[model samples]
Target: MHSERASLGLQIAAIGGLLFLHLPILLIFLYAFTVEERTYQFPPPGLTTEWFAVAWNRADIWPPLYLSLKVAAVSTVLALVLGTLVAGAMARSRFFGREQISLLIILPIALPGVITGMSLRSAFAIMEIPFSVWTIILGHATFCIVIVYNNAVARMRRLSGGLMEASADLGANAFQTFRYVLLPNLGSALLAGCMLAFALSFDEVIVTTFTAGQQSTLPIWMLNELVRPRQRPVTNVVAIVVFAVTFVPILLAYYLTRGGSETAGGGK
Candidate 1:
C-alpha cells in the first residue's frame, strides 16, 4: 500500500511539473483562436480561426518575419562553418592553452543574454558599425557558434582518428578523405547543431534588441506588440507561428542528436 501510494505521488508530481511548465504555452494556443480581440477571458467567449487571417493580413508582421528568417539563415551558416573549423582544430590538435581557447569560444553562450547583448552593443558602438540585419546576424552568431561547436566537438571526439589514418593509407588525399569519411561521420551532428542555432537565432530578442537599431526581428516585434497590443488575439496568433517555427527545429535537433554518443568510436 505504501509503495502504491509513493508511485501515485511520484506520477502526480511529474504531471504537475509538466502542467506548470507547459500550461502557459497551452494558454497561448487557446487564446490564438479566441474571438475576443482585446481581452483574454477565462474561458474564451467564443473560438474562431479569424485571428489567423487577421495576423496574416497585418502588414507589419511580414517585414520582421522576413528579417528574422534572413538573420537566422545567415547566422546558422556562419555558425556551422566557423564552429566546425574550430571543433576540428580543437579535436585534432594539441597546443598550449587549448583548453583556455575552448573555454573562450564557449564563453559568450555561458554569459547572460543581457550581458552578451550589452557587450555586442558596446562593441558595435565603438566600431561605429551601423546596426542592420548584419548586426543582428553577428549578435546571434556569437552564441550560435557555441551551440555548433559543442555539438561538433562532441561528435569529433567520438570519431576515431584511426579512420583518417586508414583513409590516408588507402591513398585518399586530405580533401578526398574529409569529403568521404569525415563529412559522412559529422553530417548528423552538424545538421543538429545548425537546426538548434537557427531556432535560437529566430526566437532571440535580447541580443537582437541591442544589435537591431531601427530594425525589428519577429521576436522584437512580438515584444513590441505585447507592450502595445492593437489586437490581442492577433499577437497570440503570431506567437503560435513563432512557437511552431522554433519548436519544429528543436524537435528535429533532438531526434538527430539522440543516441549521438553511440557512434563510430564506441570502443575508443
Candidate 2:
C-alpha cells in the first residue's frame, strides 16, 4: 500500500510540474484566438481565428522574421563548421591546457546572456564594427558554437580511435577516411547540434538586443509590440509562431541526442 501510494504521489508531482512549466505557454495559445483586441480577459470573451490573419497582414512583422531566419541559418552553418573542427581537434589531440581551451570554448554559453551581450556590444564598439545582421550572427555564433562543440565532442569521445586506424590501414586517404568513416558517424550529432543552434538563435532576444542596433529580429519586434501594442491578440499570434519555430527544432534535437552516447564504431 505504501509503495502504491508513493508511485501515485510521484505521478501527481510530475503532472503538476509539467502544468506549472507549460501553463503560460497554453495561455499564449489561448489568447492568440481571443476576439478582444486591446485588453486581456480571463476565459476570453470570444475565440476567433481573425488574429492570425491580422498578424499575417501586419507590415512590420515580415522583415524581422526574415532577418531572424537569415541570421539563424548563417549562424548555424558557421557553428557547424567551426564547432566540428574544434571538437575533432579536442577529441583526437592531446596537449597541455587542452581542458582550459575546452572550458574557454564553453565559457560564453556558461555566462549569463546579459554578460555575453554586453561583452559583444563592447567588443563591437571598440572595433568600430557597425551593428547589422552580420553582427547578430556573430553574437549568436559565440554560444551556438558551444552547443555544437558539446554535442560533437561528446559523440567523438565515445567513438573508437580504432575505426580511424582501420580506415587508414585499408588504404583510405585522410579525406577518404573522414568522408567514409568519421562523417557518417558524426552526422546525427552535427544535425542535432545545428538544429539546437538554429532554434536558440531564432528565439534569442538578449544578445540580439545588444548586437542589433537599429535592426530588429522577431523577438525584438515582439518586445516592441508588447510595449506599444497595436493589437494584443496579434502579438499573441506571433508568439504562437515563435513558439512553434523554436519548439520543433528543440524537440527534434532532444530526440536525436537522447541516445547519442551509443557510438557507431568498428563493427558495431
Name model 1 segments beyond 4 Å from true: 1-6, 262-268
Reference-based lDDT, each prediction:
0.88, 0.88
Worst 10 residues of 1 by lDDT: 259-268
lDDT of 2 by residue, 177-201 (tens): 9999999988888898888889889
Tell me each candidate's TM-score. Answer: 0.93, 0.93
Candidate 2 differs from the real structure by a C-alpha RMSD in angstroms, to one decimal, of: 4.2
Model 1 lDDT per residue over 42-93, tens place: 7999989998987889999999999999999999999999999999999889
lDDT of 2 at 154: 83
